[model samples]
Target: MAATSSLFSLSFAPSRRRSIPLSRSANPSSAPSDLSSKPQLIELEFLGPKAGGDGSSPVDRVTAISGEKLLRNIMLENKIELYAAYGKVMNCGGRGSCGTCIVEIIDGKELLNERTNTELRYLKKKPESWRLACQTIVGNKENSGKVVVQRMPQWKK
Candidate 1:
């Protein structure tokens, strides 16, 4: 019983605490001013359906920071419609598993990352301009440019 009590006391003993200092920049002016360190603005132009069947506007232009973010996230953040009615209910939530988030790159394809293996498998028969927004990254964190995107129509899918 004494040994058990000692073991219980040892287990309940207070643990040692270590203080960690918060890291902060010594001089804000000394920070690197290189272009790579700055956030690049990526202008996005979203073209809705031509016939306006989905009740969305024809064109929407927005800006995002170039930081290797997914195109789907940028579109969603900017309130741009990226999915159709059916796709809204049956999407993979940016996992690249479902190809419902397809967008046509009207221009500035160079600003996007290369197609992933999932995109290649899913869009093998599709046009080269068609990209899965879930699998598409807008910029490489250093490039600043304008990208024109057209939302894929429901009938096109």
Candidate 2:
């Protein structure tokens, strides 16, 4: 039984190694073509309030695949600061209920999905530019463009 098991293992080992090289060779050739045909990347620029509280802040640029994620998720993934000190402690964790994840859309509004019902109720009196990041979807996955977002509005800070 031992001898038979060892023979079986040895026979399969060489075949497994041979298959690995064939799969690796095939994948590299196909990967580039697939990437080229995929949709263009969406660029996001997050602007934090100026330290002086008087002018534009420096831009933190990030990119994502269109329509793949929410604004809050993208900001968190990139380590961009999206909440005020109070909001950090009280945010609803992307459920669109707490309204702590609000941001201003400075540009590329068309790339995002329309305001959700939660946003409409929460921001009824707020500017049209103000959006709840947790409710904002970045793109339609088909459109690609630059979106500028102002993180943590000054009033909140």
Candidate 3:
């Protein structure tokens, strides 16, 4: 009972917001910093389970510009295969209608755009980490300049 009362009192305590000016926040050093540097590039890693069930993983690397191309395009250009049936058929053709190109976001959840109506419909029962590669666009400053993803580990029939 005493612990609960103290918890309640703490919850009611006033909040202190420490706001720092944007310029100071960006430059922590006493000396002025260079402002003309280019934006940092992101390293995108794509991996998959190797065939023959050997438990080996093959990884592909690609540089990314946040908020640019869709994930499928990047994977295609970089030769990363998130779907087994890729290049075999239309496979929704980046339409986000089919969930065949699902990939698991190992990191950088906030970098991708919001889910589309098609993704919302198809991915209802899937885990939050799962997203349609065709529907996801990688690259965002909020992701610490990197994004990592893997092919979905399992398929649902």
Candidate 4:
């Protein structure tokens, strides 16, 4: 007798059967028509060589980090010293309104969260690419959204 192929795969849970629209963004925060004028959804990939010590800093090598991971790492790496403050201060760990984790995306502008009044206040007057990291977390699904991050402007250095 020949083995039969089941119509449904029982290996994965039924609840996990959710599908993501490839050409469109399921996240309202990352929508394209957002007031910010920045592309709200895209897949960002690591562009260049690995980041390491050859007297090279994080910015020296081209490393791609998801919007969420980037925010967490920045807060952790800087010991929470970098971000600015928001109303009453925040402790919920980046639910996207504190405006503390504002950052600029140097490349791959498509992947990001919508801009808000809080974020606008924090980002200094500059060219495009500015965004709030805490608000821009990307999912881990294949070819999920992403945004490229770079160090703060040179003057802030």
Candidate 5:
């Protein structure tokens, strides 16, 4: 008991600590500006039930701030419901684990980054159009165009 007490009483600290320097950001906000001369916009078409299981429209189009990341812009930061199942913790949290965040790339494939290994593995069983919303970045090298996307196609409601 005395040895245990002594161990608890001992002060443990790092021998030397290194202070990391912080880099200055061009923008005050957390979001960085796209390289395009004009602000890039991600155009999303939220596909609803075509046969009308719910009152939602067959397709709902929305234009939002030009965020380069798809999951961060749409799922995390915005109210746009890209999937029937949504999660930050329960799902992969944009790491491309859970396939719940899959969306169909109707157009603007060039606008996105590339298919992550996670998406490529998970989507092997699915169609080529299917992509994990979290893995898909909105803008690409040439950011002058709009990134068009269609929400999950299997969404009945």
Candidate 6:
């Protein structure tokens, strides 16, 4: 019985993901085993200083750290929680879907995940600086996409 259980465990256990070298040397966009490029917990103030949020005035640009806790930061800052839109209307919840929880990529685009057909469709409709929250999962394991998100005024829930 123990041997059988051991075998079952071995088979069922999740396999570690392997990282492969980038085929195109021009832009070696490799998916590393570790998210080393991600930040640790970037804070993106929604309203900005003028609105009494934080940071310099003229708030409007999005912010993020490569490995930061995105959702926690948003919650801590009292910003709108878009996680609620995941799966139902947005899907991926934070996996990056529905495009409902979209945010402008005010700064870091290189650090984000490559866009999908679904995301591209929405992005094409809007300005180039936008991306879906659920689909933008890049960055640290703790954070969905290591990005600080604020609900777009145009998005309906």
C-alpha local distance difference test of each model: 0.84, 0.89, 0.72, 0.47, 0.63, 0.50
Error (Å) of candidate 3 at residue 31 is: 23
For TM-score, the strongest prediction is: 1
How would you encode candidate 4's per-residue C-alpha lDDT over 1-157 as one tens digit per residue?
Answer: 1223342444344536555334445567667654555422334332222335564434322223443354545444544333433422553466654554555666656444555565667665755576666655443222345455553332243
Instruction: Please write out the lDDT profile of model 2 over residues 90-154, one tens digit for every residue.
Output: 99999988999989999999999999999999999999999999999999988999999988775
Model 2: per-residue Cα lDDT at residue 97: 88
Candidate 5, lDDT over the whole model:
0.63
- Per-candidate RMSD, Å: 5.7, 5.7, 14.9, 13.4, 7.8, 10.2
TM per candidate? 0.75, 0.74, 0.65, 0.38, 0.60, 0.41
Candidate 5 C-alpha lDDT tens digits along 72-126: 4565465666656444336655666777787777777776777889898989988
- Local distance difference test, candidate 3: 0.72
Ranking by lDDT: 2, 1, 3, 5, 6, 4
Selected candidate, larger lDDT, 1 vs 5: 1
| Better model by TM-score: candidate 4 vs candidate 6 | 6
> What lDDT does model 2 reach?
0.89
Model 6 misplaced regions, further than 4 Å: 1-80, 83-97, 140-150, 153-157
TM-score-wise, the better of 2 and 3 is: 2
Alpha-carbon runs more than 4 Å astray in model 1: 1-24, 27-29, 32-37, 52-57, 153-157
Residue 99 in candidate 5 has what lDDT? 79
Which is the better candidate, 4 or 5, if ranked by lDDT? 5
